[model samples]
Target chain A: MEKMPKWADVILIPAISILLAAIISGLVLLATGKDPLNALAIMFDGAVGSSRAWGYTLYYATNFIFTGLAVAVAFHARMFNIGGEGQALLGGVGVAVACLYIPWPHWTLALLGAIVLSGIFGAFWAAIPAFLQAKRGSHIVITTIMFNFIAYSLINHLLVNVMKPAGVMEPATASFPEAAHLPNFHDILGLVGIDFAMDAPANIAFFVALLACWFLWALIWRTRIGYQIRQFGESESAARYAGVSPTKIIMISMILSGMFAGMMSINNVMGEAERLVLNSAEGAGFIGIAVALMGRNHPVGIVLAAILFGFLYQGGTQLSIQAQIPKEMVVVIQSLVILFTGALDHMVRSPVERIFLALRRKEA
Target chain B: MDFLLLLDTSVLGTTIRMATPLLLACLAGLFSERAGIFDIGLEGKMLLSAFLAAAVAYTSGNVWIGLLAGIAGSLMLSGIHGLASITFRGNQLISGVAINFFASGITVVAAQSWFGQGGRTPQISGAARFDPIIWPGALTRIRDLLQANLSTKIYSQIISGHAIIVYIALLAVPLAWWILYRTRFGLRLRAVGENPAAVDTAGISVIRLRFGAIMIAGVLCGIAGAYMSTALQAGFVREMSAGRGYIALAALIFAKWRPWQALGATLLFGYLQALALRPDIIEKAIGVKVQVQLLDALPYILTVVILAGFVGKAIPPRAGGEPYVKER
Candidate 1:
């Protein structure tokens, strides 16, 4: 077996995978009787043609970043935590409870409280499955999938019965206090006299997401515990031989993963919607899986992959409105990306490695 | 008498209706998992089949055609899974996940573009949908033969007047049991799941066997999806399968990968679903306002408990979720 160069492994493989995904997505567009080239133009124009589009793209990216980091952190420990959806939903509940119940004097204070509560709530939801996996040998993937449904039902009940204010028919919490509202991108840019989109939901939470990426990078690569997690993921027996407890690594990594997933509510629930609503996660948790896979589980890679998906989401919305193309086209594209990058990786890798090997032999 | 009244024909009938898809899907999962492949994409295959089935049934006005189309659609997805997991030797779970997302997205995209009814097909009727098969004078004959009573009526109704697919689903259990436990193919299938290396050494192609199992699961899921759209409902709705695929997976686990037990588990889950639909009856009987959400979440909760070993342990196939790699 020939080993490919590092650059080929990191950059070349993903580039080819994306090209493959794009080709399939174009074929899908053609099958639907839409012009593939025209659809591409529409997506490009919608995603980055204007500052407002950038605003929406970055806002969506913020959610993906948090969830992506959550998944990447767990992936480092070889745990597939598919419960990010449920964890994020519970995090929204946490944000809602904190914002609606607590009379914070300022947005900064409120944001801090929301962050802590959301993280704790998300971690709490993940802890059960993690405990089951760590102590009882339950499959984390199945347990996490089950937890997602349970969280949905739980949130539905809470929004309908417990949180709905009197006289409101909607299944959502009442608006947060005015002070609890975080400053949007427009307001933040106004501090430096830069004009920006006023209606865009991009807010201070986007910066928080970036900060989370840095935090995760340090936690996963720099810390001693991170080494243990990586070791455990590589081989459980080897980790056990090296005096690293598999149980501890699984619990810590999962809890951290849940915390990141939960913190996503700060961007969507607090900064964007200003109230807790049903289905607030809106498939971002699943999108995180694609992001982590395409990015190869690196913090920087996750940020870039998240932005790409964020573009797809925002652009897909535009295409739906303008060209009558279903927004689900984005989902098809995302699935193709996941398939090519995560599942059929070797389909591209083996060929690419062979090419690299031939190139090296010719040079020699 | 009160207890008997609570367990009336209506309740039992709904239970069977709800359990039909579940039973089919559980059997599908059983076949795949028993062959060492974890197919979390059952929901996706079922969803895609449901959409294709409804769309074709409405257009051609033939339920059987729709059923065939649904099966073909599911097999297509199963082929993709095989390409990724068996041929490419990729992560089986990731392949399943991708297939699920692909099905979910493609179904809605196609439905919305083709029918333009907010991701649903036109309501199918007449011969396009499977109508209930009522045995002539079944109710009267049972009453006359056994003396008129509620119990006899319940028994008669439970035994007759369901969609033909329901009977097929019921018969499939015994068939699946015989195929799994009584045949050489079944032995090879089970053996491959347990230890592919051993199977490989014994001159069997592990890849071919796994692909066979995946295809079988695909066909079963197709029937289940067709039953949902063509037999149970009039047409397709977006995400109509909902989480039934996951619930079926749970039922498969609860049954510990056995055929007869899969039937019992699915029936129990279907009963819970039926009871949830009639919360008023539950409230009256139990004298407590049982939250419907609790009922909706019960299967998941119970599966978690079972997975945690609070109940009898569920040990999966040793080689499940792993792509077999032949040593060079």
Candidate 2:
């Protein structure tokens, strides 16, 4: 088999796939009687037009980063953690409990406490499916999907019966204490004699996501457990030959994946909403898969992919508001991107590899 | 315990009504999974069909024409899935996910564009929808129980007064079973899922067989979608399928991909849904208050328990989710 040049494999393949998806999307817009170029301009303006726009984009990107890293971690162990939706929902439970109940005098202290609680909650939720996959021969895919529905009901139940303020009809818990509110980028920048976007939800969690990317890089490449996980993902038979226990690797990797998914609540629930609302996690859990796949399941790659998707999401909303394109059309475009970059990846790669191989053969 | 009191004819009737979509969707899933294809896009296909069915039924004022339109709409998605996963040899799961997103987005946008009613078609009613076919009282009676009492009526009414699609959904199980076990095509279909390479080696067109199976799935999903719009509801709502496809897939897994078992699993899940729908009646019958959220979550909880091997192992077809590539 011919190998693609490193640059093509790392950069060019995704660029062309995305460009193809964009061209097709443009055709779709034109078919619908919309101006594609004007739509693109509006999206660009909405996503990066001002610091406030960047704040919104970065806020969305932060949620994607956590979930994307969650997906990337599991992909290392050859596991698909579709349960991130469920895990993230459960993590909100953890954050809500900590914020609403804890008598912390400071937001920083509350953030630390919430982080540990959310991680534990998410990990515990993931462990059940992990146990089923390892010990009971259940396909992780079906179980995780089932768990997502279960999570929604569970959270709704809690909000309605257990957490809702008395006489409140809506399915939402009380807002967090003022001390529990996470400091946004504006606040942090203000401390350092700088200015930033006001009233924006792009909070300290963005920095946390950057830290997570670096942490994921070190964990997957530098640690012994990471080596074991990669080995197990690459080949179960070969890993067994290397004396690695499949059960241990599966459980640890999935728990870690769930933890990252759980930590996303810090960005969404803790930073953005400041309340544990129904549907807070949204579809970021599912979007994480595309992010991981497009990034080739690497931390750096996932951050980049997450930001790109963030741009799409923010920009797509602008198209709806400004250009009269349906917001759902963005979903169509995003799915097309996923279709090309993730599913039909070889469509771009194989052709590029062939050309590279032909040129090398001619040179030889 | 007054468990028997909870099993009222009304509950059973609701169960039958709710089970129609599940039974149809799972049967659809059974065909796709049995043909070495992993179809998680059943929800999307059903949603698309539901919209088209309602839209056409409203326009044409004929339920049958709407049904055909629904089937055609669903088949279009199935064809796309078949083309991507089989012809393109792409990742089956990714294709399935993409199909789901594509169907969801397309349906809403198209519905909003065409109807301009905020992503819904006009409400269809009476003859435009599937009205219940009530059997004659005398025909539903036993020879000795001709007395028109409540008990006799309960016994007979359970089998009567349902939309035609409900009966079709019930009849589909036996028909699917016969077509699966008692036919030559069924044998080849099962063989292809287990070992497509072996089927390919025998000079059979694996692509055609798989494509045919997926199309059969599309038809079933179309009926399922049509049932939702024309029989259960007046018109299509956005996301009317609402994860029933995923639930049906879980039911399919619990059924171990067998037709009869699929019927039983779907009915069980449907009964759980029915119980959730009538929480007041259930609480009164049982003389105990039940958590509505827990009731809503019960089927999923049962699915997880079953998937955890508490019940037994549910094995998938060996070649399922693997795109069959022709060897050079």
Candidate 3:
């Protein structure tokens, strides 16, 4: 084989890794007496085969995008926000309280109340750990993970007793009223021969997430605070000497990260599900870490990574139905992406840097 | 209505039983993290081990062998983590995430294929279980006294009969404490986590030390899983670790990565769990009718509250995540 060009390693590494993973999955399928091509085809078909499937896929992608952005933002601050689940949980609680308990005559007011409350709740949930890290010097990883558990049990209790609709079998609150339901635009579009469930609820939230990403990009690359955060991330001592308040930065980043997560849940509570439910976001928050890593902590990169995950998620379900495979194959694929990305970090960096340097030299 | 009588036994039992798995997991985390390896994947590993312990016990008709199998399985996964993170200089968080996702997928698939069990394994037989060893006279009296009553009765009722694993878990605490504080190995392990280069200069192998710690964590996690499936519940269910591994991790953190401190944190969490489950007793004890939901959230709420308050200055080892690269 021709020796791979040094510059090409940047792209080749992941491309080769993904191909290797697909081959490995293929082999696993064959070993289990399944056709690989058929599985792949079904996965694609299921994800984008029909209008309804595409609609649902869009809805799923929308949620993933927001949470993925949340994770990405924290990663930029060099803080791992694993409490995305907890933050989202509180967000849902906020939305539920706003919808069920708040006195609202107008639909727009109710919607605004729910969104604002969700963000506040999420920020509050995350603020505890942020406070610990800022003031007490607690490790972000463990503290955030612990907080996720607290959120789960706390929500479970509240759902079972206080918030739950009586006679409900599972731990879920009452559905919001019709006025509170965010319209699935796809369903409305159905009257004009354009219908899909996947992206039905795709609305202003997507734009908001995109806008948030842009804002984060500008905040990270442009502003003084962004420079201080990067400086702190690089060397805490130096950043402190430079007059940046490390504690304040830690708290602010965590709260901001968490607020973004709160907005992510608005898709479910205000848009798709229209009610608070247990295990909401499932593990999307965790998946956001993978997105952040794949995106290389770049805002635009996160958008692409989120979309890729969305495709895998949609396609994986299709493959499962078609090939009688477990949909968890998608999870395996995701784990592989993270594994490859992490393992190939060196490859992605030096080669790309070298390429840029060589191009600059040639131009000069 | 003699409600107090019923309340005490249930509270005591729930506290003891609920605390057992958390204790085991916390101890496991304490050991691993003390040596400076992040063990966020404990829940996934424990779930895998628990499922396998139940499966092997159900199949081979030997709980001892099943327990061993679980320990071995966890060790293998831990070894992978050690190799990937320690030897290869891979990211710790990524490796943990991989181990968790891999364990979850592989265990569920294996269970689905082997036992044709959907979401859970079939309940195992009595022989596979760890039965309590009941003793005579004083032990019997102690058992009755400790049985869920809220009187100021302090006796040795705890030794009446619990599965052998329960005693082992309780015993492991002191053993871990001893291993951590008294031994030369413990000092070296701490040294390795704090500063691997210095430890290396001191002629100790950081790689071997960290690997050994990770493996020990795996073995303890295996026991924790075994207790969860056979002793606590009769069968293995999907996600049975149910984030308990993570809780153990929390306990370890709450204790600040110390073996001895973990005992207090785990028990506190257990007490909270017990309180949640036995809300009637809690209500009466506290003299307030707390909504059961709030009661259930006691452990989590307490975790946030306590962690927020005390974890303000719990500094980890200086070279915790940085991989040791030997100079040429």
Candidate 4:
């Protein structure tokens, strides 16, 4: 067998896999007694048709972006940190505690403090498993999964008792102060001459998330730590022989990965809602894994992959309401992405890359 | 103190019941893993079996048949995983995860379409549920001494009071141990996991043995799920198995993959879970001061701590993840 070019092997296979997935999904729609085109149009409209719909879609993307980055960060070190859900959940606890207990004279500083504290708490949550893996040689996947369950119980306990709002029956903590709420650009625009129907709870966090993605892309592709992490991923023993402590690298990689997930809590606590509710982050952490895998664990690839998922999530909800298709189809789609992406190798990558290259050549 | 006495009974009962499913799952993991197949999809298999078993019990009004159906369903699912991983040489972890997702979607669709229910199946009648198998009139005295206020059926449902199934599950420990340590078949299975090429050279078919082990794991997981939904609760809810199957895998590792050791490890986890769920015990023991939810977190906390400490020396099968291809 001939060895394919390195770049082609990495890039093209996943692209073809996505195309094949799209075709398979279309076939699935046919089998499910639905018109593929109509369903697609409805999904697109729901995700990005109007200004209000577009705002919601963008807001959804913001959370995905951070989570995708979290998964990507760990992937760079050849570590599959499936514990993004736990890290994100624990981070939300930090943000919730800050909003409820931290006394700040100004809303902006308080909100900023809460977000920063979220990163610290998330890093701490991840540190436990990282320490186990680094010091004791425990597998991160199983340990991280165990931590996710622990976080679930711990968060549930805190919400129902210590952090809960007084006189509220719901198992949720107190709402954030008005000053701590995220600033929605469209909401701000409505006050001026621009009269667009933008959704409530939409915010500028999406832009921040987009910028963060670009920054991550630069970090991985340009920086020294990025190279070291990638080198470690390629071969831990070789990297160790080259003087990098496997323990330190694993610890730092997990902490950095956790910080990305922690930022996702901000989108939920500050942007999506004002209070910390039970399972509010909802499997975004797991979905982030799918996104990372679909993106081939590349920073830019993860960003694009996150957006695609965001579209599906935003669109699926709308389609369920309008087209009468089940909203849970989004979950199915997510699963399909993981299923196909998990299996592919050189077979899927080459043809897609050659096609893209041909298109670029024509454009040039 | 009155509270402390109540807490003691609650703890004992909770431990016995909780340990039931965990023990079964740990045993299932031991079967497949010892034979050289990584069975991460135990979670999915258990969930599929739980849903099917409950739905069938409610529909047919025969809990025994439902139990059989659950085991059959899980075995079929596990067979598919075995084919994919063992026969096709696919990645075990990914295949297991796919099975989990597929099981979830299939269960939800089947539940909604067949029973016309949303996420939960119709609750089975008392006649259709697994009642306790009491050992005649004299055994009733032991129940009182143990403060087992619940019916003998409930005790046997998940624990000792179970029909032939409970005894069989316990019996499986030594049986699996014999297969792993005493038999040439066991040697081949372990060799397949450690190094398949060597096993191939020894003229033993690694593929066939791994497939057999995988099937055994699946059947055991199915029975465990059936025990939960039909025997224990007489109903099934969405994601009812939760992640206990994976936890069972953890237990197997914690026990160092020894069948007898797995039983002890599984019992510890099962007890922790029971202690967390029984609120009556918590209130009595701690003077109603602490939150019950905190207790629920105990099992997971202990799992992380135990695995980190004890699993440090766990040496996974050498060729565990590598897809075996015959040298052409």
TM-score of chain B of each: 0.93, 0.93, 0.88, 0.88
lDDT of 2 by residue, B105-207 (tens): 7777777777878788899997779987777662343454455666655755567778999999999999999998999999999999999989999999999
- Interface RMSD after interface superposition, model 1: 1.2
The docking quality of candidate 2, as DockQ, is 0.60
Q: What share of the true interface contacts does each candidate keep?
A: 0.76, 0.65, 0.38, 0.33
Higher-ranked by lDDT: 2 or 3: 2
> Which candidate do you rate higher for DockQ, 1 or 4?
1
Which predicted model would earn the best lDDT? 1
Alpha carbon lDDT of residue A60, candidate 3?
Answer: 64
What is the Cα-based lDDT of residue A241 in candidate 3? Answer: 93
The C-alpha RMSD of each candidate to the native structure, in angstroms, is 2.2, 2.9, 4.6, 4.4
Q: Which has the greatest DockQ?
A: 1
Query: Could you tell me which residue pairs clash in candidate 2?
Result: none
Task: List candidate 4 stretches off by more than 4 Å.
Answer: A1-12, A15-41, A100-111, A185-196, A319-327, A344-364, B1-14, B72-91, B126-128, B138-160, B282-288, B310-312
Clash statistics: count for each candidate: 0, 0, 16, 8
lDDT of 1 at A203: 97
For each candidate, what's the DockQ? 0.73, 0.60, 0.36, 0.37
What lDDT, from 0 to 1, does candidate 4 have?
0.76
Over 4 Å off in model 3, which ranges? A1-13, A16-37, A97-114, A157-204, A319-324, A327-329, A343-364, B1-10, B136-157, B181-183, B310-315
- Supply the TM-score for candidate 3: 0.86
lDDT of 1 by residue, A252-306 (tens): 9999999999999999999999999999999998999999999999999999999
List residue ranges in candidate 2 displaced over 4 A.
A27-33, A167-169, A190-194, B138-151, B154-156
Name every residue pair that clashes in candidate 1.
none
lDDT of 3 by residue, B70-188 (tens): 88888887886787678777777777776777677667656665666664778997888666565544344545565534332322334445678877888998898888888999888
